[model samples]
Target: MTYCVGLSVDQGLIFMSDSRTNAGVDNISVVSKMKVWEVPGERFLCLLSAGNLATTQATISLLDERGLAPAERNPSILTQPSMFQTAKLVGETVKEVISYTTPAGQSADAMFSGSFILGGQIKGGKPRIFLIYPQGNFIEAGADNPFFQIGEHKYGRPIIIRTYDPKMSLEECAKLLLVSFDSTIRSNLSVGLPIDMQFYEADSLKAGYKRRFDKNDPYYQTISEGWSDALKSAFDALPPFER
Candidate 1:
């Protein structure tokens, strides 16, 4: 399994994903689940994927191949005029890849399914983000819901829910997500790191900060340990319940 999140704040967008995939406890490996595409001043796209590794990789490869030769492939991801259209193209590609992999007449099984959190900005449009499902359908982030998370999401969702704010700065958003990711990592074995994170500043039309956090990263270590101690202190500060 994996964990990926796309958050939208007033300052910009943030994307993050864990890098562990395993067939069994004995067969574990690390592979990046993040893919990024850019056209300099024209557009910037970031994709965070979850679910079957084979399905996700194939879908991305097809998109990348088409993007590389847009003339022959027709509508390339890079050529989309808006973030909405780009998301639709990704959903279609995901559906096509899954359909081809599943046996004829048998519905696409869970083993062959994948999902994505797609976020970016097209030259003439404001930044946006979408959660694309396995059925070739998607929902965009908006005022009410400014973020999306996929794969092993439950373990890390509460923190985001309690603290997310539309007015958060890009750096604050990154810190919040790392705390969320740290919470998830402590509780789930399937979602191990090095975590990949990317930032896109509002109206920048280009990528912003990007980093990968491995188990030994100094900052990550600080956050992880600090959160644990903070949680204990918060618990102790609570009024005791008298039976």
Candidate 2:
């Protein structure tokens, strides 16, 4: 399992995903779940994936190899003009991967199947965010749901629901993401350390402010520890529900 989150604010998009994959408690491994692509001034795309590791990696490789169209048989993400089209292409790719792995004619509704959050901007267009499903379809972020999360989402969602504001500064957005991920790390054993965070300022044309945070990173330590203490204090101050 993994935890990945993406925030869409007026300023732009912030995405992060942990690098943990495990078959069992004894067979844990690290693999990045974030995929980034850029065409400088032309376009920039970021993908956060959560599901079967094999399926996610296969879909990413397929995206890189054939982008928007996969050899005429599969749709491509690159050739799509809008982020919306690109998402469909990704969803198609995901569905194809699932088809390849499952028994012929069986429904691809495997419990640990597929899901992805796709966000990016085209040269002449405003930024957009899409949540692509296993069925090769998607839904964009709306005003009420300015964020999309996959994998170990529950542990961190409340923090986002309480603090997310469309008008917040990018700095605050970043801090909130840290707090969100920290919440997940504390509660889940499947979602482990070494996180990748990517921030894109709207209309920048190129991706900027990408960072990797692992166990030894000092600032990451500060953010994680500090947020924990803050949450504890806030809890202490809350009125009791039980008499």
Candidate 3:
């Protein structure tokens, strides 16, 4: 299991993902779930994946290989004309990977299935984010729904839904996401971190800020401890229920 989130605001987009994977309680390991692709000032994109690691890695590798090849030599994420088309290419790639791994006439929805959150901007287009399903369909984030989460999402969703503001600064959004991931980390053993994060400023058409926070990172510790205290205080402040 894992937890990854992508948020879109007026200024730009923010992404966060936990790095723990487990075959069982005794066989846990850590690996990055964030993939980034950029062409300096031309375009910028980031992907956060959750589910079968093999499936996600293959999809990313295919995109990355194509993006690095000579221009127009073959279809690649870099060759797509718009963010929407880029998303379609990613979806198709994901579906293809799933199909190749699953036997014919058998359900492809086995343990090998996975999902992705793709966010960024292509030159000459506004920034956007999409949640791509294993079936190759996707939905974009917008004013009404400006965020997407895949993996162990429920534990971190309430805080985002309650406090998210379209006007919040990228800095503020990053802080909020830390707290959200903190909530999930405390609640789920499978979601342990070293959290990875990325930020993209709208229309910049270039890679943005990036960072990683391990368990001992000062700022992350502060947010985790502060949130616990805040929750306790809130619970104490509420009036007692009576029959």
Candidate 4:
């Protein structure tokens, strides 16, 4: 399992994902779940994936090949005129990957499973965000819903709700994501470290800030330990319940 989130902020978009994937309790490994594709000033796209590792990898590989579609006018990710078109390309890719991997006679639920968070911008458009479902359809982030999450989402959602403000600056967006990720890591072993994060400033049409936070990173360590202590101290400082 993994934890991935994409935030639709005023400045642009913030994406972060944990890298851990496991076939069983003992069969665990780290694989990058976040992907980026760019064309300098024209287009920039990033994908955050969660579900069956093999299927997701296949989808990413296919997207990397460019123009797998037969239609001459079907704009590929790199050539799409808008972020919405880019999302349709990704959604179609998901459908293809699942079709190629799902075994005959197996139920859809039992066959392939995965989802993606697609966010980025094209030269003439504003940054946009979409959450693609296992069935190859999606919904975009809106004013009421400014973010999307995939895999092990429940544990970390509260932090987002409490701290998220659509108008917050890009740096604050990054900080909020890290705080939310920190909460997820402590609560679930399936979601491990060496997290991948990318921040895209609106209308930049170029990838701006990118980072990776690992297990031994000093600042991450401080945040984790300090937050734990602060929570315990707060609990203890609260007035005792009626007795």
Candidate 5:
């Protein structure tokens, strides 16, 4: 299992994903679930994946290969004219992977199913974020729903839902994501650390700050401990019910 999140804020977009996968309790491994593509002043795109490992890796590998080949030879995300088209391309690619990997006599939605959170901006368009399903369909982040999460998301969603503010700065958004991720890691053994995070400033058409937070990172340690203490204090401060 894994945990990945993408946020659409006024200033730009933020993406975070844990780097943990497991076949069993004893077969755990670390593998990045985030893929980034940038074209300097032209475009910037990030993909956060979750679900079957082979399915997600194959989908990302296909995108990477097409991105490096001639546009006439294959469909490449870099060739898309808008973020919406880019998302459609990703959705189609994901569906194609699911089909190609499904064994004979098995459904396409078998154990190899996967999902992705796509976010970025194209030269002539505003920034956007999308959640693409294995069925080749997707939905965009909007005013009412300015964020999306894939994988072991339930453990971390409450914090985001309760505190997310569209006007928050990109830095604040990053901090918020760390808290969300920290919450998730504590609750789900399948979602381990060495998180990969990326930010994209609106209209910049370039990638912003990127970082990795391992178990020993000082700031991450501080946030993890601080959040726990804060939560405990908040809980203790609540008035008790009358008997």
Candidate 6:
């Protein structure tokens, strides 16, 4: 399993994904679940994937192959005139890959399924984000919902729900996501990390800062340890229960 989040704030977009995949407790490995494509001054795209690793990787590989041979493949993700079209293309690719991987008479929605959180900006349009389902349909992030999370998301969702604000700065958004991830990592054995993060500033039309946080990263250590202590204090400060 994995955990990936795409957050949209007034300043820009923030994406983070954990890199752990396992067939069983004894067969754990790390594989990045984040894919990024950038066309400097024209657009920037980041995709956070969840679900079957084979399905997700094949989908991304097909997209990359099509992008390089655009004259043969009708719509390259890089050539899309808008972010919406780009997301549609990704959704289609995901559905196609899953269909091709599934055996005849078997359910494509079974082990072959995958989903994505697509976030980016194309030249003329304002930045946008979409949650693309395996069925080739998607929903956009808007005023009411400014973020999306995919994969092993349950353990980390509450913090984002309780704390998210549209006015948050890009840096603040990153910190919030790390805290959310830390919570998830502690609670789930399947979502271990070396987390990958990327930032895109509003209207920049290019990629911003990017980083990877491993277990030993100093800042991550600080956040993880601080959050544990803070949580214990908060619990202690709450009114005691008495029957």
| Candidate 5 lDDT by residue in tens digits, 1-243 | 899999998999999999999997799999999999999999999999999998888888787775454664443778888989888988888899888777554564438889999999988789999999999899999999999999998989999999999999989998899999999999999999999999899999999999999999999999999998999999999998889
- Cα deviation of 2, candidate 5, in Å: 0.8
| Residue 50 lDDT, candidate 4, scale 0-100 | 97
Instruction: List model 1 lDDT by residue over 1-243, tens digit each.
Output: 888999999889999999999887788999999999998899999999998888899899888885466666543788888899999999999999888889765664358989999999988799999999999899999999999999989988998999998988988887889999999988888999899999999899998999999999999999899988988999999999999
Q: What lDDT does model 4 reach? A: 0.87
TM-score ranking, high to low: 1, 5, 6, 3, 4, 2
C-alpha local distance difference test of each model: 0.91, 0.86, 0.91, 0.87, 0.91, 0.91
Provide the TM-score for each candidate, comma-separated: 0.93, 0.89, 0.92, 0.90, 0.93, 0.92
Which scores higher on TM-score, 3 or 6? 6
> Over all chains combined, what TM-score does candidate 3 have?
0.92
TM-score of 4: 0.90
Candidate 2 stretches greater than 4 Å from native = 66-76, 104-112, 239-243
Question: What C-alpha lDDT, on a 0 to 100 scale, does residue 19 get in candidate 3?
Answer: 97
Assess candidate 6 and give its TM-score to the true structure.
0.92
In the range 114-146, model 6's lDDT, one tens digit per residue, is 999999999889999999999989999998998
